[model samples]
Target: MVDASGRQARGEPQGELAGRLRALQELSGLGVRALARDTGLSSSSLSRYLNGQTVPPWPAVVALCRVVRRDPRPLRPLWERASNPLPAPPKSSRQGRPLPRNDLPRDVPDFTGRAEQLAAVFAAVESHRVVSVDGMAGVGKTCLAVHAAHRLAADFPDGQLYVDLHGFTEGRPPLDADSALRALLAALDVPSERVPQDGLEQLAACWRAELARRRVVVVLDNAADAEQVRPLLPGAGPSVALVTSRNRLLGLDEVPPVSLDVLSPEESAELLVRASGDPGGPEGRLARDPESAAEVLRRCGHLPLALRLAGARLRHRPGWTVGVLVERLAAGASEFDTAFAMSVRQLGRPQARLFRLLGLLPGASFDEYVVAALADLPVRDVRAMLEELLDAHLVQQPTADRYRLHDLVHQHARRASAEQDPAAERERALGRVLDYYVHAAAAADAAMPFLSPGAPPTAGRPPAELPPFADKNAAFAWLTAEYGNLMAAFETAAAVGADTHVYELPRFLRAYFARRCGTTHLNVLFERSLAAAERLGDPVRLAEAHSDLGFARYNAGRLAEAAAGYEAAGLRVAQAGDARVAAELALRRGYLSWDAGGVEEPLDLFRLAGKLYEEAGCPAGAAHAAAAEAWATLQLGHREEAARRPGRCWTSRTPTPPGRPR
Candidate 1:
């Protein structure tokens, strides 16, 4: 095919052929070899092209023109006139409808809140070459990633390529790195047969080589882990990659992770409002009570799937009110169970069982030991099972050795547990898990001695196995790993109506999980325990739980609620004939009322508390109460009497000297 000058003879249309070839040969004064040296195309390809034996592909033609010192525009018209056309691609097949998030269509409603997370994710996209959004399952990681990507797509010229690694899709194996690379290669137009097999390194090289000098954006969704993502990274040139994974993917140190937490109340409401699909209508009226709206989000956990489903349910029947929806959500276990259950049912039976078993464990997140206890299997088997369940998205593997499920998913798992085993069988199974954690936590607590209302247990039942407490360091590590799930178990047990668990788990955990660990969510969950106590209607435990919840509420800024709760606890104590605890609650109620703006009813509580304190034979408590009454006297403009009281040994530590600034 080489012509006399060693250039590949050029190919052209039979009729216009001679003229185009004559023009090209004339343009290339140095002929084939010279053009080959300049363009990186082989002399044979050039000669074949010039001698008219073959037509050149676009890139080849562009190279030829560049080497020959000619503008491509002259050949452009003729090239454009050529009859070549690519084969049509196969029609896209539908598998199932993915969650309809507000990440696209420019019109879908985005939930409110996460203003900081939205900004953080956007900053990552704009600032980094590759960013990953990683988090626990149903934490809205994908929503945050996709929303950010679509917002930044303008900067990526070659186009955005979004592929779900399907790493966690039910019943699917993770698409290996090589196959994912091939998919990327195809999107970039490398000839299918030319794609090298088994040479993933080579394929990756080719993919980057092709993508060099262009701006491209690639999103790898639901990756199993870093190994599955390594080859797909575009290392050769300018590009951005956004990877979402259940695994933390710490293996990729440079892939900055946006490990998402659950949505806050505001964000949940915004999502509910959008899902409710109202335009200046009843949805607005419903959203007016963010507390109830937050309750819905709480039941749904503000996960994209759960929130979207909640919206879908509301939208499906416009006649329903928010309160009605709340009534349905108050169904406790069955609220979002149907939808999350189907998501689990789509998984293999083993993975589904693993997911259900995860529900039997405590916490929003947990260590592998809980898995071992629930499955009654070796840690290794539980590890593998957890891995598979995570990849199927039936469970979320946030970090190595830690996993979680959505609230809705967790409820369904509990239902599955209740159904799959005999009552004793299930109780014993769950009891082992509870014991495993409590035992482990107790050991960690003994070793660490975190800040709490109590002292080192000079006592209680001996633990099953002592953690490496002899090594001061290992205890910290174990506690760090197990802390979240330990707290989660307390809330989980209460939610599951686990009678002993409702009260005992908190007592066991409060010693280990504390403010030093930044465990503030405990305050919110204790309120739920109060609700649980109310539901159980046990007078002694109810009063104790109410007092616990009341203190937590006082610390959490719900002062009025705290005051009311303490008052309610006093009533419960009174009914139970526990006058001593009643007096303690009276002191707390006085303090709460005094702090929450009063010189009136709070004055009443403080005065009453003083009488009770005196009657209870605690003079120091009475003196403290007298000090608070003195302050209430000052606030109500009884300053002469206030001057007379002289801060008589304040009965409560709660500061009560000030009144609302008038």
Candidate 2:
């Protein structure tokens, strides 16, 4: 007999009879029309009987068995069983209708973050008929949606329906919209026979009709896109559809989307504490060492999935500290790689390639042009691919034209790149980016005057098609934007033994670093340059490198190191027969003495530097030395002695500005 949805629901007798009929048909090797002729029955009627859609009379069953050369007596009992009606549900349980299926997952008990997001979802559910929640994989989109749905369940008395669309699932394709519609319809208590199975539109119509007068809550979780979610949504009614996806689903109409970011550090720590099982036990220890706790959160990328896993790990290991977990994560241990892989696996080949290359990029963020250069693709293509990544939440664009991978995503990309891309290919890609920055920074540096005029020039062919800088301001702005990246590039080059790049980049960066007052990075950059220069064993280059390092160290208030750097530069300059640079170093050392509050020694050193500068026919240098000697005399509280001893230099020069030697 046919069930309510028009599909066959056969009892044991019907199953046996249908099995005998099908065997007879196959043994006879006849079509339905031929079988009908043999049985003197209409083709449609015989087909229904054989297919178990309907039961036939005893005479018809016998006729079918006889046609297949079998006795009908053995099938009588089977037919009797098939004719009996199926049993009904218990009277108490089947009073009126089935209870509303509350298939929503249990809310996360330690759901520590997203107070604002929860509030927003609550507010949106009140005003909007549909709410879309989207974010990176493992950022708690599903958890947040479930929590919100549970809170809003009372508002919708009809029922709550939940479905996992399997979007971005590792090995399976996303659930199709038609299948999803059938599922939603089934959840709404539509009988199997009545639920439309032909077209998505028809199924959608049935779904809407069911929810039209009711107040149901639908949670379509892990959706593939707007297309998959659109038909599943109930038509305008008291019902609410809460859709969650890794994709942004921007194409959905009038559905206000909420994008979830990683939890704040405070929230992350709180989550860790709560998820630890013993909130006051291990959490109390974490509270005491806030810095280490923060490190643990950072290692987890402040993402809920990672944090939960870390917390679980900590809970299992009672003897382990938060710092222990942080160390493990720092040493390349990760639990969220698979979660990230699901999203990356959804990208097209080009987009995937761009993402891997992004892992090799130097800094936290980059623009399209840098991405293009790194991937060796056209900028237009890179932009389009980046948009795809952005939509997938694999990358984030915090500001216009600048994109960055989340820290955990970056780690995944790096691991993927190392595993999938050849070492040589990665090296080449990194080289291209480093070369670009070196030439680009040099171009920017050219538009700005040197901070220290005596520093040596960098020797390299200008890279072609570099972005133009209209003036010093534009150049400085570009440099400022790329400052961190440039520093990273320098560090990368040094690590790879690219000595020429290592030594040359700082020479170009000195002006910008000084202008920006970036003493900390300057010190590190120049120290790296000195090491690279020493590896090359070029005395003049070493002299200039030491000079740059000395200035950087002096600015950082490392006077002893600064003095040693200048002394090392003086020795190099003397070996290279650069009397002018030697004189400059002597004057710098004299200024250092003055800075150390020594008057007589600086006075003597400045006098010697002045005579040497005069011998080199550098009048400005001699005048600077004289001015500094007079300043030293004034520092000794002998103002008259300072004025008379260096009258000409004092009359011609103003007091040296701060951070500038006279």
Candidate 3:
């Protein structure tokens, strides 16, 4: 009996088939020759079968089964497997082939999460000849690919080959397809002289031919794009190739692509704990403060590379708490900056400039129009540049028409902007964004009548072209989507001494804040507006600012502060000669006084405000003051006076309801 290679099998028949055959022979209580006689087969053939050196023909096995009184069914499957062993590589192919190289980087010891991703990759390689893992820089695409490749190494016995293509490396051009193929050829043990010194197609053909019958795993890391990776893929066979890149590599649609995102919060903490070297030490301490640990992870953007760097930093600095590291990262001093820079450096000058300007944007995300406004570029150009940035993985579109920078990438872009862009240019870009936001908010406010019925008018000229919105719903949606950014723009305006914008932006937002019933951000926006108004020292604006601040404070239930704010605004109201506003301020102060148990004082203040409002031609304000006086009169236990005051003073309109003051 012979093996698949046509050589005589040596040694005892091995594995399950050998054991079963030997058992049957023993059960027959016969030596090879005796078994052969009993089974009607030649002695040498029986000997070979019994030794697992060959598979006997079915009739011969049936004769043996009868002699041994054993079943042939169960043994037949084992017999088949033993008979058809996996084929060996041709002698010539194996003679000078390079030794198998286990070139994969060490798997991350504290690698956390990604079970689903790993399974997807494994499943993909089973059917697809090639798979690519892609994601933003520092998102751990290479790490994941390497780990999965190592798990699958045993299936491809010819070798595991790896090459770094330098796709996003700083100060270096990406490895071209021809050069990558040569490296792969050399790894496969094709002699240096034999590798074709020709075009990429010829070299790729030779590489594919070499892998035609072999089962090998090739990993091409940091690929710049599909073009750089195309020649490195092996031809159809048992071989598989895994490619990792920051770019999406959409050009390789034939190859299944798995995109990696940042780690989840829980997995991120686990990684930090495990990578910290002493989970029971500082990491353990951090575990007790999950909020702080979560903050650390958030500041790190839950990115594995950032987490690893932070974990290592914490591991080495036993004296430092996780909060310390969090503060550092929050201040934008992160190891991830270098990794992010590599991706940025790959961008074209226009795209890089857009990326830098995007970092200056106050919100977490923005639409193309906002970007256009900031960059002073046409909307179409902004959209195209954004697409370029998206393809490079420096920016991500979390949803349709909305692009956001990863926290870490945002930090890097900010740093790059500070370093590369001049101070004046940064300020100018920021000014443009603030101006755009102010005008856009005003337009939205104007379109939504329910929100701005009695809202204060903005002081600036209208923008030449308002941002397009289909209707009130679209306007409200835009406001809601950009609420945080609007707040940031308000604060930034104050910081940069854009005093007119500072005071004007909040006026447009005030109605939105009131309509949404947003107290927290309202307080912040008005406070910043007050500061800006104070800097300008315009008493009319000051009165408006103080009135807005008092309103926010009053809603927040800080009655004493609200009263003081109203009182301060009253002093400015007379200077500004707005008696109607003065009446409003007096009415607000009276409410605070009534809430604080000063019934008599509040009644007197309300009466005085009512007289001033009537004189200033604000009958609604006069009636509101009258209603407040009636309420104060009732609170003072004078039911008759309260009833009489309501009849005589509230003739035209009812008072603004309590807690509904705006």
Candidate 4:
């Protein structure tokens, strides 16, 4: 309610506070999306806050106030009251609630023959509230799990959630338990501020608490092992979980295991008939060519993935008889090979070449841009070819616009590429891929400038084009999504003795690691990059590697080792005479000194850092160094001098002293 003064009445604090926030946003003259972009918030969440549906977090309120140049301290009491409002009625008493979330992938229309396994899955979920479906690759573990989830969707009306743990994927590491839990919680529409940023147990507890209130079915697909999936299970509720893995999760003793095998010969034949849309009974192609049909089935090993691919080939080429398919399979050395070979042979040369080169891709899954880089083709051309490959069943689109090879298909592509493409050509293609990642990562890093903004030197040919990142969030999203592939690229570079790439690539990941990942992996990457830098015999690069290693060590709390790395960097950087690197080294050394309890030395080093940064023409670095110096002065009991400093210091950003990189 508003008074004659057009101000909120004394009561209704939530409404008053929301009105103030809305007024602040109006003052800023930005639309909802623009304000959200400026405030680092999702528009949906911001909308809720402005409409009084939810209390904005303190930081969010502060961000909003900052955008409008208003003092937020005046609003603290009202915010606190709004945030601590009376508890609402229980879920049982709530009315007109939203429908449950459903993220399950579409069920295969021709999902054939897993009757006994499907029954076992339902029974296990009923009894144990969890089921682990384990089998060999391409035996339809994921298919059966997804199918079962779709079938049980009505029973678990709370929601259906799905997550791929990326276990047994060719190049990507399995998703860790913490990340998996966060994904689960996010799918439940939990606010980002509510999710714990650290601690596996805390995240798991939060997930359990949320699940306890509702009946949801979660599919933890492509899990690496029991340990990875253990924390993702619901504790006590109508909610249940289904896990699928290539290896049997023997460690999940409480969860019943349903092991799948290749389809039986009869089932396989039926699947082929269904997949190929062949007429049933004595007049069908299989009935006319029994011997060849058996050969096709044998070649497929009755594996669902292989069978589907083989069946697709036959379906697409109606003129070809079973005997002709068998003749194509004869060229392959193995049963599995025959199935894949037949499908691959149907592709046009460019599509076929792209298929073969996809085997050389280092990541488990990739988007079209990366594929374009790998195949040295236009993205439009790659998209068309990918469609062709998709139809051939040579590639699997696990998600929209992202593709991967079935393990069997991956092996076949590798073999075929090796036999056909020359070694030099393969290396060149991989080099192009590495170059694309380096430039892309550099571009992303540029969007989100870290303490040291020096670009890493690219060693391979740059791609014809690169992906665009519009803002820090866009850059961060790209980094998070491509982290696994970037790691794989680094490893591939090291394997091929691409020392320059090995040394340069990890430099781009420092900011990402500090945010999403911790220092352990960062330390490992810098360690490897340091070795690469040494191999390349470039003093400036070596200094950068050492400085980066020191930063990682410092973040990981290895102060002594960090000092050693800084010392090494200092020596090498002096010899190279790069002003930017020298500035970085000085700033890092200042941080090291401050961290090690040296008062005067740190202040001196900070001053030197400030001077070098000015020389390097980096105002951000200079300001950071100046702030460090001011903070150190305050530590030395020179409060007046520290207060007189021109720039504001962000000492509260870190728990420790003023030693963190800018």
Candidate 5:
């Protein structure tokens, strides 16, 4: 390809790179002709180099690498390619070629259990070219990330790299995000650690420069948070990143949430059967009983670690049946916790304490509540707790105000509680919640008497010193404000065997009915209240609840059901011989029959109910009944007949046309 001028006279070197070499000679103080003279090359050949016609050979390259003091190894490939570009390979088998021997660790173990999660991670690898797999510890977040990165080998030609951030591990001081960034920069084949000491910006620019178009995948395992991941991002979308953490990394506002729940019953069993290798013999019939499998899964809380442990136990003791394992698990109340303990035992003491304290809180799905409750100190006091746990992926803060532990984490939390606190401390932690609810309820109940107009506030200090809601209106206000929360507390107390709350809580909430909070809300939860009252055998509470339920049902328009419920209440009331309540329920039942109107004797029933209400001195009931009769009479196309009940018909409040008291 040489020309008569001893250069590429006929079509040789293409563009920019050729120009750069010529600039290199001028800048390095090697005047083109003098450069040729020093290397014993022709002027014309040197001119061609300067004019960007032909790239010079190795003698020139050695000269260049020496002047720059950089490892010329990087530019060598570019130089050789320009000298003679390799023919583009044919399209027949183009995929997953390894990086040129320097991109990753010697071996990355295959990660199992979280297949769907791994698949999603891989899909992110495939689609985003940049992905972060974030979740809590023993949720197998990292394992899934590793597998996803490996699966995406085809996506990235530049290869995969891994780093353990040690964010959650005890005593293993976490590298500042910048230090981690430096390590990543070095991994990308950047020669100098002269990476920026301050901003990760320069290093990230270098990373993009290094990985640009190379298509690498970086598994930023155990990341601290977004500030950590953001600086490390190559920005070259061709590169994929999967981050693993206990923190929700809500810090990365852009990434969609890929929440990892404890495995489902079926998923857990598949893990067990696959990991333990068959519940033994003939299509593993032992594994096929879904109930037993579900029980086995439940014992493990369907978490991966416990499932893996159960599977491992079975694998070692091949003769054990699924039922035997389930029993062992059922007996080990800390079984899931035991499984996570194995993972945590690998951690240092400080981390273990943090992990344990995280378990001793009042509720599942916690937040700052967890920080204060478990650590038994302010979130401010436990300086790096969130970061530490986040790195380990032990605590998952998937959203604002929402933090979840993997079921495995809950298991670990139980274990953590036993180790971190004495039984008394654990009880104390639980007692705070109990006492808070009890006192709060006492306050609300003390306020309840005020809800009914003109009902002088119940005094005498409640015999329990329950706080006053200032006055009666305050009681109703408190009840109204805390209705849902109070109900939730009541349910919790009831579940924990505090039957006093089970009986008394509903009475306090009876005023809740006025809000018309909707039948759906009642239908969902109040049936449990009725069942609790019945189980406790409280006739008074039961009668009141049934009456309230009947009224609720009637108001909500399940008329026949309401009538049945009121009749049930009435039977109980009549037996107790509470004449006023008995009379009211009786009127309500008769009115239900009249309004329903399938019977021909509706007028008779209404008149009788009206008389009963009047005898009981409930003008509201009498007025309601009178209104019903007039409405029914009008419905029968007898408006003239409807004018008959004047004395009973809010007569003190209305005048009649015919003046008939009939």
Candidate 6:
């Protein structure tokens, strides 16, 4: 291939250019973070460039070459070619696509009431191709949206997609617009390399473009507001979207919405009986005691979730009359309290304890292993306990092995745990959860080490066992799935003054963030970690924290703040007398200096780093520093002197380094 500069390139422009740029990075012997620090590029962006997932701008290519003293002019032809590759072929209009995706959660079998509301949703969809269902918590917003999507399935034959935005989920933050857009695009089979890494507007445009060529239905559940759901709507297409939120989404003026309320008294009575499986005969409990049945409906507040829990309790007890159920629920004030308290009261002590502890869980949903950790029980025993909770309708089994509590139920459980469990017991349970995540994250980080050449020592006590990660892929999958929960754990630990955990947890997520999430969240985490480290007053940890914060700032292009961090870290490292940390610090300091436009000072820093690494018995680190010095020498046009350094450096590590693990 040839560019307008009339220079010939070989192989695919993007892939080949990425390979050559990667070679330059290897020649300097710097990890991805180190390279990004010196190049004034975000680590996430640089990672994407090096992995051939994205094409860097011309200036970025020049920056990389300048660091290693490679001639940028020679690579310009290839960079130009890569920058303007032919666009992808247009997708056909769903004529021969794969089988339709059915990601909607299983529709409730005993779906009672909401007849008018369902019809309203259908009417809105017919007019706008988008309709939102808004209601209070536990009022069946999600149920209505999913039911409508399933019923309208034949109209949009391409696929059915579902995304739980986690707007009001306990412990987890609302899913941001960018992450939500990425999920929606991925559900439509968009390739990762094709998806934009930054810019919510760009991702949304791509999502709309993709949807325009197909007929599909998407259920966007638990949206925080209109801004979160607006970008996900289809543009001028037969495809439709159904959004569910607790509050009215006034911002989505183009999309009609159905405002839902609690079931009518008659509808509520019918639902309670149907869900309880009481026969129509006079011999049944509902028929035998009309007054008590009405009381049960009142106690449930005519809400669907509360009614289901109440019905499940009655269905499981054959001997109990309607009056007995009412008496058990008579003490609570709110519908959630009445229904959730009665259901939780029926569990054995062990199961009840597990249910209460689950309230402390920080993720949107969890599997049995996390349950085991939170309850400090054996995994096998935890499975049976979770089954019992699911049977009581206290916990929702969204998927086969993943479960979550309804929002109202979660609030009730949290309240009950605070009332019943002691402070120390609650603290210990949450500590176990922190330990579980830190240990598992560290293990997963180990299996798929990123540009982490000088990783710190792992912290936190490990649990009795951890889920096995068969390979890097499996490890990453686990990390991605648990990311929200892990963040929640970090926040919980920090809030409770678990300083050690607060400082240690973010260390494992750096590589993950560099690949999937952007630097914004990573920067927040390291900032908090820095605070926790200072509180602990451990010089080594404090120094590491400063260095980590500096690295994050450097990636964010905050050079002045990054310099301040590095200076503080140097003082702490000197006090701690840790040669390994001192060497890493020196190496990073050198990169920062180089990026700040100093040619000679950075070389001196590199030499000092190599000497310190040698003294610390870290041959790899010493080699890395030596290579950095050689590259700086070459950048200064001292080719002969630079040639000798690599002969020694090459023996310590592989010459052709692999791409980022992610």
TM-scores for all candidates: the values are: 0.38, 0.43, 0.43, 0.76, 0.37, 0.79
Q: Each candidate's lDDT (Cα)?
A: 0.61, 0.74, 0.72, 0.82, 0.56, 0.81
Q: On a 0 to 100 scale, what is the lDDT of residue 112 in model 2? A: 79
> Which lDDT value does model 4 have at 191?
59
lDDT for 246 (candidate 2): 92
Of 2 and 3, the candidate ahead on lDDT is 2
Clashing pairs in 4: none
Candidate 5: residue 527 lDDT (0-100): 59
Candidate 4: C-alpha RMSD after superposition: 11.8
Clash pairs of candidate 2?
4-193, 5-192, 5-193, 5-194, 6-193
Among these predictions, the greatest TM-score belongs to 6
Off by over 4 Å in 3: 1-349, 445-476, 500-508, 512-521, 586-659
Candidate 6, 41-150: lDDT as tens digits:
89998988887777776567878988998767668557756765655566674356667778888888888788899999999999998999999998999989998888
Q: State the lDDT of candidate 3 residue by residue for 1-662, as single tens digits.
A: 44422332343224456567777877878888887887778898777766656565445665678786775655544544454454677999678745686767667677789999988899889889689999997888878988988888999989888777867753235666765675577567676545664456778888888888788888898889888888888886789999999889989878988989999877987888876765565438576666777887877788887777667666756787767766666655454873355446557899999998888887666888788878888888888999978766577775686887765577677778999999999988887887888889877876775311233445443433446878888897788677657766766676677898888787677656655533555677788889889988988889988987998888666777887788789888979987777777777777666555454677788898789888887676677677777755553445576677742433222221233334
For model 3, what is the alpha-carbon lDDT of residue 448?
72
How well does candidate 3 match the true structure in TM-score terms?
0.43
Worst 10 residues of 2 by lDDT: 650-659
lDDT value, candidate 2, whole model: 0.74
Residue-by-residue lDDT tens digits, candidate 4, 1-662: 34312323545668788898999999999999999999988999999888877667556787898898886767865876675555668877576666788878778778988889999998999899999999988889888999999999999898999887888766456777866786678678775656765578988998999999988999999898889988999998789999999898989889999999999988999898988878879998888999999988888789888788777878899899989888887887876788888887787888889999999988777889898899888888899889888888787786786787776788788888999999999988999999888888888888885554675556787787677899999998888778768888988888889998899898887777766664566788899999999999989899989999998888777788988998899899989998888888888887667545456787788888888989988888888888878866754445677777755454432211343672
lDDT of 5 by residue, 1-662 (tens): 44423433433333444555665676668776776666566888767655666566534555544554544444544554565554667675355442442333222232345667766766665565556666545566665666666666666766677766656643123445655665576556454534443345665776677777677778777776777677666675566677777788787766644667777666676777776767444568354565777776766777666677666666656576677666666555475654455445545776677677656443434445334544455555444666556544466664444455654566557666776678886665554444444455555554544211111122111222233468757776555434434554555566677655555455444444433133544533455656766777756556655665676566556787787787778667756654445545554555455434333465665566567667767665566656666655644435566667543333322322111111
**For residues 331-379, could you state the per-residue lDDT of candidate 2 as single tens digits?**
5545477445545665788888888888888665688867877887777
Better of 2 and 5 by lDDT: 2
Best by lDDT: 4
Q: 2 or 4: which has the higher TM-score?
A: 4
Question: Per model, how many backbone clashes are there?
Answer: 25, 5, 3, 0, 13, 0
